[model samples]
Target: MIFYHFGKYILLLKSVFRRPEKASIYKREIFKEMVDIGLGSLGIISIISIFIGAVTTVQTAFQLVSDLIPKSIIGSITRDSTILELSPTICSLVLAGKIGSSIASQIGTMRVTEQIDALEIMGINAPGYLILPKLLAGVMMIPLLVIIAIFLSITGGYFAGVASGAVTAAEYIQGLTTDFIPFTVTVAMVKAVIFAFIITTVSSYQGFYTDGGALEVGQSSTKAVVISCISILVADYIIAQLLL
Candidate 1:
């Protein structure tokens, strides 16, 4: 059974990658879904990013100030970590909890209702039609969202620094820029793309294989999000170790 499931998983992956970049047939429909995924999910990303930044700042500041480590290094450490690792990775987690589940649920529902089968009957490739736009949208939008996440996180760090009396605004800004390397942002964007692919692919796969009725769909959706989240967190560590 395990081998059989693995075989199915492999085939599913092949199906997705083999046609991931095909000219989309349902362009309008896919674009609408992309808009929903990218634009509609923006608010949650912003909130989570800022809040994480603030909390990270508070923790880092306390440790630095407590140890009497030169508060000079605080901004560099904070910004570098946030840009290269925390923002993109953490925001993906947030989206996994929020948007990932929604995608899984929506796709699962369609599957359970036989909508996908109907598409197949009409000579459409259900997998390609349903999953490609979402996949592409994930690729396109996550980097942009990661930028927002990093920015918000930095802004939160600034406020947190001021509130905690860690460093003056000028000093904090100066330190942040002193070691600011652009490669960190590139790493972040790369992470975001990986995360996007992970979330979309896992969620779509979960939803696609859903059988039975409403309860099964619900179960599939839950599993999709959980799997997506775990995969991303694990992948984040691996990617960070490799990149940073």
Candidate 2:
């Protein structure tokens, strides 16, 4: 079953990456998708990122209750944890649910309603027309979102540390500036890109081949989210192993 689906996914990807019929039309579609997927998602991302960073700081501070350890380590720990794991992974997971399900349902609905068929009747490469722009948008915008998430998460940690009296503002700033590795940012970007691709492609595949009616569309959406999440985790582990 898995192999069958994987093979279909590969074939769909080949179709999606074909040359555009009209560069102007494709560009317009790409911009629209970027706004829909990126700007539309900012509010939820901001809320989750702030709370995740704050909680990480509080929890890390609580765990390191030792006189031998410097209080500034709370900031360092929170910074590293947020950048390395929390921001990219958690945010991608949230996006997989939000963006992935939307893609699946949108495409699935079009498939069921015969819109895709109508495009084909007009001599259009329906898959390329429908899915390519979304793929482009996902890859371009998700990394940008992750970058924003990283900054907001670190800021949240700083505020939480200072407000909780777990660490002084000066100590947090010092820790944040100390021993920062540029490579971690690269890893985060790599993860973000791979996750974005997985979310877009997997969900699109689920929707593109959807069978039956409205009930099936809902099923496809749910399946897309589930599959995208599992793919993200697998890709996350692989990227960490290779990059870190």
Q: Best candidate per lDDT, number? A: 2
Whole-model alpha-carbon lDDT for candidate 2: 0.93
lDDT of each: 0.81, 0.93
- Pick by TM-score: which candidate is best? 2
Q: Show model 2 residue runs off by greater than 4 Å.
A: none
Residue-by-residue lDDT tens digits, candidate 1, 135-164: 888888878888988888889888888888
Task: Tell me which residue pairs clash in candidate 2.
Answer: none
Error of 2 at 219 (Å): 0.3
lDDT of 1 at 161: 81
Which 10-residue window in model 1 sums to the lowest lDDT? 17-26
List the candidates' TM-scores in order.
Answer: 0.91, 0.99
Off by over 4 Å in 1: 1-3, 17-25, 66-68
